[model samples]
Structure formats: C-alpha cells, structure tokens
Target: MTDLFSSVALPGGFEEVEHTADWAYHIWAPDYVHLFLQAARGLYALLGAEWSPEPGTTRRVKLQGVDYESLLIAWLNELLFYRYGENLGFNQIDITHLAPTCLEATLGGSPITQWSKDIKAATYHNLAITPTDDGVEATIVLDV
Candidate 1:
C-alpha cells in the first residue's frame, strides 16, 4: 500500500523526481516521454499490477501522444499495459512538474482478471509538441 506519487526513478536510471503535478499541465520536453513512461510503470507496479497482455481477450488499448497529452497518455498507456497485458488496473493518478526542467507523474490503476490486445507497446503517431502555461507540453497519440 504505497502512494503512487512517492519519489521514484525514471527510465535511463534517472536520479530521482518529485512525482507531483498541478491541476493544469504545460508542454514538456520531448525526451521526457520515456522518463514519464518509466515513472508510470513504477506507479502501476507499486500499485500491484502486471505489464503484459492477458490470457484470452479481444480488446486493444490505444494511446495518442498530443501536446500535454504525453503526460496523461504515458500514464494511461502504462495502465493499459496493466489492464490488457497483466489484467490489472488502478484507480487514481497524480502527475506533477516539480523542477522547471522536470516532468514527473504518478498514476494508479485497478487490477482485473480480464482484457485482450495484441499491442506490444505505445506508439508516437501524429505526435506534436506545443506550449502550455507551466512550460512546454506535447501531444502524443499512441496505438495500443
């Protein structure tokens, strides 16, 4: 029973981040996507979920990376990974941009025993970045 937003390490062995976010978000850098994904995975795993597809089902999850959408998409895609892949889900997600040069996120999904999909991973189709209130955000449309 750990808080999903607890400090965690991102991908590429990032040092550490304050996985907290405000109600509104802004466009972040491009390289932050993978880092966000790693954080989302940590949140999903910490909440007790799987990271693969289910045994038998016919459902697919799609994620579209859009401006400021990457933050939400990254989190949802990870949840989709749990739901479709591991049959697990979360309930809540908390994201944040701690440092002016940092983009951290926290997500929670519920665990279930059902789901279906052939999606191997998230896609960056029609992706575009834009400016936002906080900083720089982008739109990432993913295909589950």
Candidate 2:
C-alpha cells in the first residue's frame, strides 16, 4: 500500500499549499484520528503561534454534523474559537471517539501569544476527505 502511494503523487505529510485568497493546507495521516490532529497542528503552524512552556490547560471538544467534512470544519472552528477567544493553542490532542458525523477530543496545550497572522475560520471550499490505501487525505481551506 505504501508502495502504491510512492508511485503516485500523494501528500504523505502535512504542508501548506498556495491559494488564491485564503490559507490552505494539504494533510494526510495513518488514520482519521491522526488526520484531525495533524490538521490542528497545521493550523497552528500557519498562524505562527508560539505556545507557553507550561503544560497549559486541557479542554474537551465535541462537534456534530452531517458528515466527516462538516464535522472536520466544525471541530477546527472550535479550535479557532479557542485561539481567538481564550488565546489558547493545543499541542497535544487525544481523540476519544470519532465517527463519520461526530467526534470527541481532549486537547492539551497552553496559552499562546505573538502570532504572525490571524485565521478567521475554516472554510468548506474544496474540502474533501479522501481515503487512501493506508489512511486518509484532505485539503483544508481557511478564511483569513
């Protein structure tokens, strides 16, 4: 399966891609759990956010929607709310439950300051979660 991806053009890791008017990310991981976690990490990296050394605080997050893509947007938007509302950024995430239309996660991280940029929200533009032989891949576009 890995060899199949090697012969094909595929995103095996997280990276930022060029977009016309918004920030976008290409991300893939070994499973849905890691996929979402990487998405969160990518968002933080795009913001150039600096985290405090403290272990920070932990929070429970839940998002329910009609499908995986919708849930993904909502989950990321919740994280964005945490960033703008509480000045928080998560460095670690534990997905306790994940389904096609719902998810529950425990995020552990710290307060952040001095970001180079601001992200308004995650958008559904070109949002697609495609399954791979070994995992899943998706492109996330953020409204900046």
On lDDT, the leading prediction is 2
List RMSD in Å for every model shown: 12.5, 6.1
The candidate that wins on TM-score is: 2
Give the lowest summed-lDDT range of ten residues in model 1.
Answer: 17-26
The residue ranges of model 2 lying beyond 4 angstroms of the native Cα positions read 1-12
Tens digits of per-residue lDDT, candidate 1, 90-138, equal: 4344444433333344544444543333334444554444444533444
User: Please, what is the whole-model Cα lDDT of each candidate in the order they appear?
Assistant: 0.41, 0.82
- lDDT score of residue 28 within candidate 1: 43
- Give the per-residue lDDT of model 2 (tens digit) for 1-144: 111113343234689999989889998988887788778778877889888787668899888999889988998899899999999988767789899888998888789866889899999997889998879999998889
